[model samples]
Target: MPLDPFLADKVHLLDGLDWPQVQNDPQAAARLGEYLRDPGEWTAPDVSVEDRTVPGPHGRIPIRIYTPATEPGRALLWLHGGGFQGGDLDMPEAHQVSAELSARASALVVSVDYRRAVDGTHYPVPVDDAHAVWRWLGETLRLRSGPSGPVALGGASAGAAIALSTAIRLRDLGQRRPDALLLAYPFAHFPNPALDADTRVEMEALPPLLRFTTEGIESMVRNYVGRLSDLPPSAMPGAADLRGLPATGIVLAQYDDLRPSGELLERQLGEVGVGVRSYLAAGMTHGHLNRGPSLKEVDRSLDFLAAVLADGAAAPAEHPTYNG
Candidate 1:
């Protein structure tokens, strides 16, 4: 559980700060936005980007579409992460991850620009945006492909939390377990000391320290869920009974504090007899999936997700349940 010397050596420790301190500082959360803005003009030629929107409860929500050369007949519903406070579909990582998966699996990747909590969106608002986009895909876009490779949901950090709840709800409603789920440095654990020592160290290694702080996480959780529940899966993945969930591929950073949550979620999934694949990328930190330099791991995760989801469509006829 030692601090990632690579990260610790490169950055300053995040002394516990009050929620207002991190939120009002502005510069704290602004760093990620700055990074996104300066992500350079680099882009894959095979990837195509387009702007779109879907009707939501309050209003229409914007989104970005990344599609491959050939439509694989399945789409990935991606929710961009910003602690539910910051971030957009145009985020550098969001663009890259969506495009990477698109090219890898030849499926459509839709990134949602939901209402952020920074302006008091809170829980169900963002979660509702996710539902609106998903419903649009199901009803309008028609995500069903012979029921084998239906739509899947995924995201990072706060977005991952929203995706987890959305997927769980989808399964319980008997709609369809996403063919597959790709979660990177997923924010699973809530503000509790239940985490192991190693997990704590890994989370600290993540850059943009202010966004993932103790209070910052709580603020996101509070904003997402109006009132706290005894064990609300809406905020904490571990709180959910993951039985019947989709085939899950969790991409975690070895040095990320959130790493334990991924492993724990995997363990819980296994306990329920759900097929789970867990990948721990070495020398990486939370959000490393988007860090330009750490793209090697991110690429690996996307490739695996492509295969996993595509396999749902290509499964042997007998076991064609499409546990994607």
Candidate 2:
């Protein structure tokens, strides 16, 4: 299939700023953050947003909670993606996605501001922060609809990896697990030669704007893993024994470099008899869900999520609809 006309245009319009360069240059990173922080990116006007902190392994972790005005409350614990190096609660990828899901699905959304690798905080730290918040949300907190409302774990990119790991961890510890999972274009696995070869070919066939390089992916993984010799299930969900994960909704972008991994995850879940639903957003690339109000597939994912939480409809869609 050819690239979607609109996304092809978006690719050409890209500023062509390489992520590795931005990470290495402080001024450029700051400027890029500022540019992405535009107030105009905020979406879902009907969702009410609030900021609060929860106890973390070290001090406090910030979180943004989004509540919709009319629907019966279902909750989601969300993490944002930045290759495990960048992103924040107020950023479009983090806040806007949550707000859109909350408003459209009438589900309460909680976005976590977990620690990143750039902060000299490596694998377990970020995962630990997520775990702390997950525990608090399950045990100590109550939603507007009280404590019994269904809560799921979710994230985009690295955040999705974290959510999946958190679910695995909760099951291992004999603690309550989320009712479902919402993973959007997740960075579900570390780089490997076979996967890398396939992704490289797919990326070359698509636009160059969001193409990923093996060197870049390796660098991000090194930053997250540091000197760790063995990665536990908490650090890498793909390395875990995933026999009994919760009902899951996975959204994959058609032209995304990570799409292969997302598909692999869906198959793995199914092989274990774990209920799973996956959406391949045709004509879209990675991070399309982060566009919030600008993309229809984003709403499609939220709709799937609402259905999963309301009633465990964890069956794959036959032919997904597109608003393009």
Candidate 3:
């Protein structure tokens, strides 16, 4: 099938922009982050945003909290996309998504700025920072009080990878788990050059205007895991035991290379008898949930999150579901 007209226009617009190769270039990553932080490209949703730092294993972790007009007992801890290297707290992918979800879900949204490996922050650091925030939010919100009110966890791309890892860590430590988990086009597994040839070919088959630079994607993946031996189930949940995780919701982009892993994770969760639902955003590419032009899909994702947070109530029937 061809791309949607709106999405095709978006692809054309992106092709005209200047994007540097971030492979081995920290400055390029920084520049990309700055480009994404432009306020002109995003309108702040109607939500109160705050900046605060929480104690972490090595140091303080910064987080932005978004409070909606209608107060609710529940909250969501959100992690932003950047392939575990480039994203920041103020970027639209992080801030705007948090704001919109807070307003639409009527739940407080906490967006964490975990350390990225691209900055030489390294593995376990990002995971540690995320875990710290989760614990702090749970204690702050008193999540153990009841089933109706608990902090949910989620992220986009690399952030989604962190969310899944943190959930596993918490469960292993015998700590309280999140009420639910949400993943948006998550790069949930490490790449296998040999086995991923078909995946790469599929991505390359997209309109030339819409495909990502090979060097750029490879850099993101390399910086994220460093060495293959370092890859653990905690960081890449696709190879992990999925039996004990919380109710899971995944949003996958039809044109995303990562879609296969997201589907695989859904199947793994189902095999373990976990409650899971996946939303395939048709005609969309990776990171569509973060792009301003893809507002319809973004709004739908928020609605799905809100529905999932409502305990004892069934998920709204409108969302297309792939339960596993």
The global C-alpha lDDT for each of the candidates, from Candidate 1 onward, is 0.67, 0.73, 0.73
- Which residue pairs clash in candidate 1? 122-223, 123-223, 123-224, 179-324, 180-324, 202-255, 202-256, 202-257, 203-256, 203-257
Lowest lDDT 10-residue stretch of candidate 2: 34-43
Which lDDT tens digits does candidate 1 get at residues 245-289? Answer: 877776666665456667777778889977776566655566765
Q: Give the per-residue lDDT of model 3 (tens digit) for 1-324.
A: 345456554443333334444445576555445533322355666888899999999899999989877766678899998878778998777987888778767778999999999656666789899999988987777654522476789999889989998899889999999888988877776552122665566566454434545465566666766765656667677778877899888887777766777887877888998888877766677787566633566566666766766541235776654232
Cα lDDT for residue 76, model 1? Answer: 86
Encode model 2's per-residue lDDT on 1-324: one tens digit a residue: 556565554453335556575779787576555533322344455878889999987779999888788863677889999889888997777887787777766777889999889867788788889889988876644533343567788898889998998888889899888888888777877653234574456567553437666777777788898853565655757767888888887877777777777878888888898888777676677776656544555557666655665555354344366221
Better of 1 and 3 by TM-score: 3
Give RMSD to native, each candidate: 5.7, 3.9, 4.6
Error of 1 at 50 (Å): 1.7
* Candidate number achieving the greatest TM-score relative to the actual structure: 2
How displaced is residue 305 in candidate 1, in Å? Answer: 3.0
User: How accurate locally is residue 222 in candidate 2, as Cα lDDT from 0 to 100?
Assistant: 80
Looking at model 2, the pairs that clash are none
- What's the lDDT of the predicted structure labeled candidate 2? 0.73
Output the TM-score of candidate 3. Answer: 0.83
